[model samples]
Target: MIEVTDHDGVAILSLNHGPVNALDLEILTELPTALARVADARAVVLTGEGRCFSAGVDLKRVIDGGAGYVQEFLPALSTAAFAWFTHPKPTVAAVNGHALAGGCVLGAAADVTLMSGGTIGLTELGAGVPFPTVPLEIMRYACAAVSSLVLTAKTIGLAEAVSIGLVDQAVIPEELMSTALKHARKLAAVPADVYALSKKQLQQPAVQRIETLREQDDPGVTEIWGSPATRDFLAEFMRSLGRK
Candidate 1:
């Protein structure tokens, strides 16, 4: 679910789930430990090993008691991402492909995001599920970087990602990793403690909002997961995907 490699104070974290790299219980469960292991690195690059960066949380998981499976889930995943967001070191996202939902949020949370021309941010609004509040907060901060592209979702192109500020650099698919690593190395030179603290201060307001939402609304997860509207949305989404 997660793979980590380190080189000269730099770390690469790859999401390696099969196919679309959708966030699932295993990935969510294991991610925090992975983040912890390389938390001391001067820089980190997050990428995925597949055609899609991540298709977001598995809809099937949600329909089939995902609420139970992930009852302890979002907080863990959010905590890990928050670590990345405020890490003293710089972080880069080498978006290899489509970064929908959770995947998009993860990329945006990075200090700098680089995308292959094919990368896109899809919120899954069509699915009828409420957007995760944590990601929305992340997106709020990312607006300067990738708002227009995120807004268009499917219409996003590599140039669009850069123009909207979602990605610091956009490159050909084959060059994505090299570009990300190069950028990460440059960022590694920043004064770590200062950079980290600065990032924390810059992000405190958004983080606080996320915390409040989680605290107040998380208890409703079970009810929302079982609601008639949720069921109808999932069914329609499944049907659209031919999963029905």
Candidate 2:
């Protein structure tokens, strides 16, 4: 579900699942492995293959697979997200298109997030799922208006996203990759050890919070996700999208 390529010294990790690049068990399970493969690269740029960064979790799969699937998927989600968030290399998110819910959290996990031509936000509440600890913490760390976005579950366009600190910059689609690479290269130029150390220090607070509360919070979140009401909501939500 991830395609890795090199641009100069930077590694570009592209999300290449379905059309919207929805997060599923296979993608979540493989994401950390992909990150590990690029560990030695000077920096990394994350983007999507098509017109979407990601549309978030695979709700159809969740609805079909039921609670048993959720038991496995939730932990995998946390593991993959934590891997991306804590990666030692400089990371940039080239959000080429829509990034909602978990996708938004993944983009925000990067050191810098830049978007072009798509809406982005946390839509978990609208989907009738609670945010797992890792993603919730990352959103709080990256976004200036986390509460409003999470509570409302409303998406905003690129310009508004930038204004609210949901994204650092907005560029045209053509400039998205180039701009992301430019930022990645700049960050790559910094001494690796110093950059990694500084990044760790900067991220420590969020990391600590995630580590501390995940055990307590994730079980409840998982329970809600697997609850019958959530399944019903997901079924209706998927139906609204004309998805089976």
Candidate 3:
């Protein structure tokens, strides 16, 4: 579920699993692999096909696999996202549509985020799952008023995303790709080594905090995922969406 295309010196990473591009095994595990393939590229543009950048984690997988699936999946997800968040190049998120929960975290982790008149939010608290630590750090770094918002798992529209700094730009749907490409080209002009090293330095605090939280909290998160309450809550969420 990842598609890569090269243009000039930029790599376009398109999420292509399905209509919503829900975060799943392949998308999580394959994303850094996609980044590796584009190591020579000057910049990267991450986006999605169909109606969403991503709808979040695959609920069906949670329902089907229970604690066993989550134990491995959660760590892998954190690992892959950590790799991308610290990718040593200019990267931009071209948010074409809805980016909920984990998808919202991905957008926030990027160097810059552009939204195509879509909604973005963190809804994990309401969904009865422990928000993973790395993504939580990404959100706090990107969004203003995040302390209150995270507690509520607030979802915001495009205007709010821009206002709160979750999105750097909000473009009309038709212009999203063009605008993102423009940013990619502009960013690619920066010396790669300087950009990479400086970025690491600038974000070192958040990065360090994320690492600490990942180490200290992943087991607890995994345990919560395995809880009967989480299962019931997740099952209810599926039923609410009429997913069976």
Best by TM-score: 2
TM-score on alpha carbons, each prediction: 0.88, 0.97, 0.96
Q: Which candidate tops lDDT?
A: 2
- For each candidate, the alpha-carbon lDDT, in order, equals 0.75, 0.93, 0.86
Cα error, residue 68 of model 1, in Å, equals 1.9
The residue pairs that clash in candidate 1, if any, are 145-165, 145-166, 146-165, 146-166
Which residue runs does candidate 1 get wrong by more than 4 Å? 144-155, 226-228
Per-residue lDDT of 1-244 in model 1, one digit per residue for the tens? 8889986678998999989888876787677677778878889888999787777777787677645654655565566666666666788998888887777788888988888855566555556655456666787887664444445445466787687777778778879888888888898777888787888898889888988887676556546655667867887888987963
TM-score of candidate 3 versus the correct structure, residues matched by position: 0.96
Candidate 3 residue spans exceeding 4 A from truth: none
Pull out the clashing pairs in model 2.
none
* Candidate 2 per-residue lDDT over residues 116-144, each given as its tens digit: 88889899998889999999998888887
User: How well does candidate 2 score on lDDT at residue 66?
Assistant: 91
Residues 23-85, model 3: lDDT tens digits = 877689999899999999999999999999998999788778888989878877887778778
After the best TM-score superposition of candidate 2, give how far the Cα of residue 181 lies from its true spot, in angstroms.
0.7
